[model samples]
Target: MYYDLMQTGLVGELLITGDNDGLKKVCLIKGKNDFIIPSDWIRDEVLFSDVKEQLGQYFKGNLKEFDIRLTPEGTCFQKLVWDALTEIPLGTTVTYADIAKMIGRPKAERAVGGAIGANPILIIIPCHRVIGSSGKLTGFSSGLENKVLLLEHEGMEIKGSERSALVM
Candidate 1:
């Protein structure tokens, strides 16, 4: 689990070392702004390169789905939660508690939130789509503002009660 710290063409970027596939996935959320990714986790490769190119296109409203594979690390329950995240449609959204129930860990809503927060792959894992049970966006290791922007970029309606509104 490593990430490269680089500000490519996006607001903020993270290049994650694919632990399972050797295929790094670059994450560009919230139009690419405001974050902290462990710089020591970087592995130099063209995987992240392709990911960056596609992410740029995706953010610019030119591309929809990303053709990237991920090998994010986590617990069995967490993996279940993250996998559920990937099933979320490109432009749709889901909540942490919702994810909890979906993974058959209904009482683990808080646990689900924990796993969502622990998500290492960001965009590809779709952690940004997991909002608060109240329909409010919350707790992205990448930041809440970035979460909102990602939702909007995916054409979400902002849920009306959104707080920061892209606090960049």
Candidate 2:
């Protein structure tokens, strides 16, 4: 597999990995704010044009779900949780407990949260849609601020959590 990096106005740095088949991972760089592309990685803008376009549209609220192919690697349970994340509609929120129930593990809210954290594909998988049961904003691999920005871009009003209460 090879990797490429791109900087965006909304999500900062994104590390995209792929092979001959399709996209493997799209990780957001949350620390140091830089992507260190491996020596073997090929930096090809043509290979990631679609990804950039779709993400730009998403940030502008013109797109709801991504159409790019994905090949995220994870355990079976993690894959299950990530798949369930795709089912979460835009402009709405669901709790980790809700995902637990969806995966037939009603008492595995914590487990579901862990799986969500392991999601390799960030905004495309919609992990940001998961929140606390009390409608509070929870952890986001890309950071809570980006999570709030994403939710707001989707036109969802932040109503429950002070953490999401932007003074604007």
Candidate 3:
């Protein structure tokens, strides 16, 4: 396994941990915080250059979509939720209840949110696109500010803590 940490201009630090087979996790690094890199993990810029480039482009609003291979570890339901997240088009948002219905568990909105929170891959998995049923920006593992920034970066219309929606 290997890992590389990348810091974007707006999104801050990102910890990308993975193996040769595929990516395992990509987490946002909070302020001034440090993480223990495994002894076996070697820092390789080349290994994650594409992700860095894509994320950079995304932050700049030059890229609306991502084309990267990811292998996030989670339970079957979580995997299903994560996969469904990818189907959410750029510049659009969906509610947790919507995801629950998509997965044939309309009564499992809270469970869907739980799965969303467990998503190891952030922007690549599009978990930020999920919002509250009332159209308000909800909890984001990466933080509300970052989530708002990301939604703005994607051209999604966001109002002052009161509403969240796509422009088109």
Candidate 4:
């Protein structure tokens, strides 16, 4: 089943997916307010007895790492991108091209963007770390403002405060 762990700042969401076998995926998101169950936002079974309690702890700025297991279902490249995101240290950021290079696709920046947008899991995957070549924050299904806020919260520096605006 899939479940969510909302961050304390109300600016991030973590999608946790798992099954009878065990946990599988953990996606982190920023500036996303939607938590509906009917849509694709969530498809796995979710009914954790302590979900609300745990979420409260998260919202209170008391929790760091999550305790839920998620099974993110996606393609190999997509998974690779997501995995790379996890490697990004907390309070740090990386560019989409950096992710492509990490995956041995230095020229597949566009492809990396596509995978990032398709990331259903959000915050846990840390797609917010990917930015424009000019070092400006960019595309995010959850909204760019939220993305910026997430970076700020993590203490990650954002360059080009003016010139480099979001294009995607």
Candidate 5:
């Protein structure tokens, strides 16, 4: 059976969904269009106690890495990209090209960006750590504002400029 819960954290309200297999999604709810709970899923805060606590620690800047089990569904290439995303250390950012090279697809930078954009599990998976080769922030599924927030929360500096409004 799938279970889900809502937890308000540093970024905003998060809609977390999963089952016994593991967490399937942890999405930041920005608006009504951001998430919709399935009719068959049960809302059970008790099932997500650990996720809540860990996220709380993260927002508090007391946690750097996540140990939660995950079961994100995606294509094989996307999975490869997501898996590489998890290896990104805290307080550091990399480019899509870096991720492409990390996965042995040195020429698949664009494809890597597409996979990164498709990442379903956000903060825990650390998709927010990706930046442009020029050290500018790029697309984040939760929006660049939240991306800047997450990166800033991790102690990275975000500078603004006319050329690249958000440079890391």
Candidate 6:
């Protein structure tokens, strides 16, 4: 059976879901109706204790990498993109094209973007670390503001009058 938990975070409220195997989702709740929890899911704080703790440490700048096992659901290509995202160093950012190359599909930047957009486990998967080719902040499932916050929290400088450019 799937278990879930609600935890307040830096970006917003996070809905964490998983089972005994590993975590399945770590979605940011933007509004009341942003996500619908499955009826079969049960609320279990005990199951997500480690997740909460690690996330708290990450937000406080005490942790750089997560040790939790994740089992996000997605197509094989999407999983490949997400795996590459995990390889991104904590304080560095890469373009979508970089991810495409990392997965051996150097010409599939747009496809990589789509897969990155579909990532279910946000911070843990490190999708926020992907930027545009011009070093500009790009789309993030949680929004660009949160993306900047995360990057800055990791010690990356964000420049540009619109707060859309990265100094990497």
Highest-lDDT candidate = 6
User: Which portions of model 5 miss their true places by more than 4 Å?
Assistant: 161-163, 166-168
Clashing residue pairs found in predicted model 2? none
Q: Among all windows of ten consecutive residues in candidate 1, which has the lowest summed lDDT?
A: 159-168
- Report the lDDT tens digits of candidate 4 across residue range 1-168: 445554445664556555565455444543344543435454533554344455556445565545555456789988888777767765666788899999899999998889988877566567877777766777787677767766766666655453355423
* Model 3: lDDT to the true structure: 0.84
Model 4: runs farther than 4 Å from truth?
A: 1-7, 12-18, 21-36, 39-68, 158-168
Selected candidate, larger TM-score, 3 vs 6? 6
The alpha-carbon deviation from the true structure for residue 8 of candidate 1, after best TM-score superposition, in angstroms, is: 5.7
In candidate 1, stretches whose alpha carbon ends up further than 4 angstroms from where it belongs are: 1-10, 23-45, 159-168
Candidate 1 RMSD computed on C-alpha atoms after optimal superposition onto the true structure: 4.8
Please provide, for model 1 over 12-38, each residue's C-alpha lDDT reduced to its tens digit, 9 standing for 90 to 100.
655456544644444544443344555
Task: Give all candidate RMSDs, comma-separated.
Answer: 4.8, 2.7, 2.3, 5.2, 1.8, 1.6
Cα deviation of 126, candidate 1, in Å: 1.0
lDDT, candidate 2, equals 0.82
Give TM-scores for every candidate, taking all chains together and pairing residue i with residue i: 0.74, 0.87, 0.90, 0.68, 0.92, 0.92
- Looking at model 3, the pairs that clash are none
TM-score for candidate 6: 0.92
lDDT of 2 by residue, 1-29 (tens): 67777776776778888776777788887
How many angstroms is residue 14 displaced in model 5 relative to the true structure, after the best TM-score fit? 0.3
Candidate 5, pairs of clashing residues? none
lDDT per residue (tens digit) for residues 1-168 in model 5:
565555556677888888877889888888777667778888877878898889888888899899999899999999999999999999998889999999999999999999999998989999999999888878888778888888888998889942365554
Q: Which runs of model 6 end up more than 4 angstroms from their true locations?
A: 1-3, 6-9
Error of 1 at 68 (Å): 2.3
In the range 52-76, model 3's lDDT, one tens digit per residue, is 8998888777887788888888999
